[model samples]
Target: MMFLRYLAAVPLIVLSCAGVPFGYLTLSSYLFQRSLPGEPAEFDFVAGFVGNVTALAGFWPVPVAFLLFAGLWWRTAAWPRISLLPSVPTAFVGLVTGTGWAIALGVALPLVSWGLARLAARIVSRPISGDVRRSAVEVLIGLRGGGRLRVQSRRLLLDRLPPPRYRESPVGRVAIPFDRIGHVEAGVVDAPAQWRFGNTSELTITPGPALRVIGSGQEWLVPVDDVDAALRLVVERAQARAKPEPRPPLESARWASAKKLWDLGEAQLSQTGQRKVRHGGHHVLLVLSVLTVAMTGYSVFRVFTDGWGFLFGALFFGAISYGTGRAWVSAGATQKLAEENPCSPLADDPDPRHRPITGWSYQPVVLGQTSDL
Candidate 1:
């Protein structure tokens, strides 16, 4: 019951950034409709230009657009009518882009934003707007409920932060300097629940993935819709704050870890003077290879004396012989050991290109150190 209430009470702080342009335009249009503050006999032509140019609020759209576009701007509060964003663009068409282009842009922009918002919202598991690539997103801190995690350029703000315990404690927004963030990792939580975007609900959670951010001597687990992309955002931002050098992207990091594992295997093989890879079926391949080779040699002779059908048999046997031979040689199995325990990792196949790359067969045994094995 408590769990249901917390889930129901998921705090929604206004995460207006990408849609700021739309939101800003909404602000300008409202001013024209309601008349701008300090209106005189001569209407505020100067404010209109400044409002169109800046688009922040109250006729200051320029710096806000540039900063928001650059991913440098982040604000907690809705500028004006941001919550009513769907109606905002249409409402602002007359002032922001002029009456002629207002209706078209108002409708068109929202449609485009609706599509983008759908995609990004699905990723972050919450409603969002604008291009996420250059905008900020709000994330839930706990797997179920905690606080709003507002990702900014140089810092991360945890707003309306919940108390650690039921006992009374000092509750305030916690700001963790982005530069201090060291490790930004992706993981999952076992919270099977439905994500409600609007009236529609997309069922896409079982073991939903979340991001674990650790830095500045603190750690935060952020449950987002798109954990991988969000992880990349945190990684990129952390690197940007910490060093001139960049951290590897997700795929690259995976490959690097795999290579490290291979390297460890190679090091072990070097020290042990043998391959310990537990790959099997090499002994069977060896027998099949010998049988196929003998059969192919006989078929080749029969092809010359017999018919074209014999030629096909000879070619088939030859291909099988080659494949089996290559696999057998690479299988890391010894004849005696394979016969005793075919699956044993300790069994040595004469192929030095085995589990580890210490070699007589693969690489030249230039030195006597690895010559024994």
Candidate 2:
């Protein structure tokens, strides 16, 4: 069935290619020669003959011949299939350049024949206007409901729409429906919160009644019928916008401890008006430096010997190594941190009655990360 379909499609493809130029020429001649009442009889006869030839050529037999030959060749050959048939452009080139030169030059003809192929490709390819592209983007973004919806269609239905409109802002273009808004709080006198979207005023809305406003600026007040709805909406928006955040650099138990030490050193240096300071343990630095130098040397050797192929292989290997190393380091760091700070943030009391706890508990940590606390 598949083979039959493939065979059937070939005739249609050939006909389409042939018919388009035929129709175009026919229309152009009709438009230009319509005024010539006393045209030469030879011209009329030649035009009729060309039209008939074009109609016959656009029929199915020509493409069927190519398809049948291809199928027969493929079934008989053991090696990879190579298309023996010449395409329209190829045939045209062969006709113009003559069969002897084409056969001698072989496939090299295509590169020389690029000018003709490119001209055909250009005639088929049409440019889309800027307005069309912009309209497409607007429709896509507006439909998603995150960005402001632009009400471009100002018909009677739109005019009757309620005030406090939900539309994409001309600025940031994020979707913020007016009904979800709670209260609008303006920026303060001393320190004004930055307005990100546009030059438009910023407002922080408490999504619902109970949800805590973690970081505050100017809050836009949304009227929510239920607390759960507000929380769900905020969470949904945050999740949708959240791409994978960048991971921290250091890993390993020793490296984790070294980072704390480094942070302490940075604090001390900052107090003394120093611009830079080294913090991590000497052993961590030494290990990292040695690894870096070894990898760099290996990369240089591979490049000199095998060029691009070696470099590609090395890059693939390096990516896998880096990812594995990062995962190991992160896990080690997490375990070490848990060991150092035994008191879980979710613990009922500030101080536990028993000995300091270590290792994972059955309960998972929800809400934000330790940094948020």
Highest TM-score against the true fold, candidate:
1
Q: Once all C-alphas are superposed, what RMSD does model 2 give against the true structure?
A: 22.9
Q: Rate the local accuracy (lDDT) of all candidates.
A: 0.41, 0.30
Clashing pairs in 1: 54-61, 54-62, 55-61, 56-60, 56-61, 123-225, 123-226, 124-225, 125-225
Which consecutive 10 residues in model 1 have the weakest lDDT in total?
A: 355-364
For candidate 1, the per-residue lDDT at 184 reads 54
Candidate 2 residue spans exceeding 4 A from truth: 1-236, 239-270, 276-373
Q: Candidate 2: minimum summed lDDT over ten consecutive residues — where?
A: 152-161
Displacement of residue 78 (Cα, Å) in model 1 is 5.6
Write candidate 1's Cα lDDT for 290-359 as tens digits: 5677778889999788877788888999999999888775443222221121112222323322211111
| Each model's backbone clash number | 9, 21
